[model samples]
Target: MAPRNGYTGEGGSSVISTDLSHGSVESGESLQSTSSPHRCHHVMRPARKVAFVYAATGRRFLGCPLSGPDRCSLFMWIDEAWGPVLSRSLIQLWDQAFLDSGRAARLQTKKKEMEQAYLELWTERSNMEIENQQVVNKLKTTILDTEIKMSRRLEFHTKMCVAFISSAVTLASVLAYVLSAH
Candidate 1:
């Protein structure tokens, strides 16, 4: 009979074997049975990935597409056991890849913040420059107004002096004519 999952163990617990051969004792089916009963018609039907568990680290295996309570007994090892040296190297490499990806994300966020700060500073500088230009224009207008007022005052003083001299000369002539008539 092709093992339909539920089998009793030494502790009388309902032990379900996700692997093809269940446990140590051989089952009715072969160890590497790809033509299992419950097969999904998906493109990657038999899910395959490297095992990251402590006991079977760096080993590649094919498992059932379903997980947890719905998993079937459809597991098979694709790669053989790795040597101690190779296993350690692969674990370290996986760790480094994780760390590098996190660091790269942080750096990207920092770059965006710096760009925002630069934009704000540039805007402030532009506003200050406009304000300075306005102040300079106002100062120039005030100076022109003061010069015009001074020019008008000088013209008025000159006219008053000419009129006073003409009046004095006419008075002196009238006094002479009165003396000659007498």
Candidate 2:
């Protein structure tokens, strides 16, 4: 029977069938029919592609289109299920690919976060350095001001000492001259 849009099978799963007569998928050759261990038939609807990550590696598989609770348990790998060893290897490869892609995405997100944090820390450090330099400059200015005040006070004290000594010598000379005259 010709598969129609929104068609449901007896198992209650939505089915989207592909026309095999076209013999080509868009531009490439049509996908030949093959038996799978899990699905009734391999359904290829480009518009209805799904990424199935449960099949060991993260690979896209042909499964029921219905999502959530309505989705059917149809898990069929895209690659051919040939000999036992070959099929197992293929599944492993697909699973690894999926895992690697997921990890890569997470690592990229982490790298961005780290870069932002580093930039913030650098900015904080620069601000602190500027503040420290300002404090140093202020300290130097204060010391210089204190030294200038102390120097001025010392000069004033020295001049006062000289004037007092001169006045005492002149007074003693006058007393001695008066006593000698008497």
Candidate 3:
């Protein structure tokens, strides 16, 4: 007869065995008929709590309670097997979420840096335009001053030439009169 719960024999006998020794039983009939309480202990009990752990910190967190359907879905031969599966799944999802958040933060930082660079470039361009305009103004002022000086020199030379021509004409007329009188 197959054992029920912790009982093994028909007359009600208590059998005790560790998990390592019971794991060698391959046949289902042999596993059920085993006269050891330890062999059936893993098959009789449902898993109660599942725990998830952070790989970096090794801190464990309790997961959600399993429903009746979920408990019934597990095989009786495995002990607390669903806990590790669920914990690993949750940890993988959390890791992906963290990685995505980090990438978004890096992109935001890059955007801020680009904006600052553009502002600095714009400011420099404005300053350069102002300096260029000042240089143009200075050149215009110098050209105007040079043109005024050239005009004044030309007027003085014209006056000197007229005075010399008049003096030469009067001297020549006076010499001709003296020669005729002698």
Clashes of each: 0, 2, 0
What is the per-residue lDDT of model 2 for residues 150-179, given as tens digits with 9 covering 90 to 100? Answer: 999888988888888888888889889999
lDDT of 1 by residue, 1-182 (tens): 11134332222223233342132221222123244344544433565433443325434455655555565666666557777877676556556756787888899999999999999999999999999999999999999999889888888888888888888888889999999999
- Model 2 stretches astray by more than 4 angstroms: 1-92, 173-182
Report RMSD for candidate 1: 12.9
Please provide, for model 3 over 105-131, each residue's C-alpha lDDT reduced to its tens digit, 9 standing for 90 to 100.
Answer: 999999999999999999999999999
TM-score of each: 0.54, 0.46, 0.46
Winner on lDDT (1 vs 3)? 1
lDDT of each: 0.56, 0.51, 0.46
| Candidate 3, RMSD to the unseen true structure | 17.3
Error of 1 at 55 (Å): 11
Model 2 worst lDDT run, 10 consecutive residues: 23-32
Q: Candidate 3, after superposition: displacement of residue 170 in Å?
A: 5.2
lDDT: the better of candidates 2 and 3:
2
Q: lDDT of candidate 2 vs native?
A: 0.51
